[model samples]
Target: MKTTLSVLVENHPGVLSRVAGLFSRRGFNIDSLAVGTTENPEISRMTIVVDGDEYIVEQVKKQLNKLVDVIKVSKIIPEESVSRELVLIKVDAEPQVRSEIIHIAEIFRANIVDVSRKSMIIELTGDKDKVSAFEELLKPFGIKELVRTGVIAVNRGNKTIKIEEDE
Candidate 1:
């Protein structure tokens, strides 16, 4: 099973390193990890995806909570959250294939971010399945390069993650 964890941490140097190190030390492989500052400059949200069983997920959460920098760690339930990933693909676009490539991009509502005589760069943001489908379709055109921003997600409704203050 793939588990997504939403972690809130103090925004400070080395915090990311420590968090990543913790996973490494425990022999846990992170499938995807994206971190960025939140609305509050002092905090950052980390979206980490790991492929493991329920026991492993529980262990990961417990271990993460022990980190002093971690403010809160919650499992992002798939049905309750909206998740997305961004991918950029540079594919061969010979004159004869340019139009076909553009048509493919249009089908997925992907943007043609860059173009040159030999290749075109397509940008798409979607859930994993969408992104993978887009990539598979572009592969026949000869992919020159590919880059992806790991998944980032948030709860679908009014629920939010925040730091708790002691009274």
Candidate 2:
């Protein structure tokens, strides 16, 4: 099973490393990890995706809660949440192919952030499948470089994850 965990921790250095080290020591492989500051300056949220059994997911949560810097850990239910990823790709384009590339980018609603005589850079943001499809379509033109911000997700409205002082 693929489980997504939203972990809130103190905005302190080495926290990410510690959390990652825990996963490494436990033999859990992280599929994607995106960490950034939250609304509060003192806290940061880490959106982590991992493949494991339900039991392992539960164990992972428990271990996270034990960390000193961890504020909270919540498992995200895909159907009840919204997620997105950002991708930037630079494609090798010549005059003849430049028009075709631009057209394809338009079809996907991707932005041509930068362009040159030889290549063009596009920025795209969407769900995992959408991003994957966009990349596959541009593969024929030859990708010069690619970068992505791993999946970031949050539960739908009316619900929010918070830290518990007693935890």
On lDDT, the candidate that comes out on top is 1
Task: Please provide, for model 1 over 1-167, each residue's C-alpha lDDT reduced to its tens digit, 9 standing for 90 to 100.
Answer: 89999999999999999999999999888999999999999999999999899888999999999999999999999999999999999999999999999999999999999999999999999999999999999999999999999999999889988877877
Estimated TM-score for each candidate: 0.98, 0.95
- In candidate 1, position 103 carries an lDDT of 98
Give lDDT tens digits, candidate 2, residues 1-167: 88999999999999999999999999887889999999998999999998899888999999999999998899999999999999999999999999999998999999999999999999999989999999999999999999999999999998999875684
lDDT of 1 at 33: 98
Which stretches of candidate 2 lie above 4 Å from their native place? 165-167
Clashes of each: 0, 0
TM-score of 2: 0.95
Model 1, residue 66: what's the lDDT?
A: 98
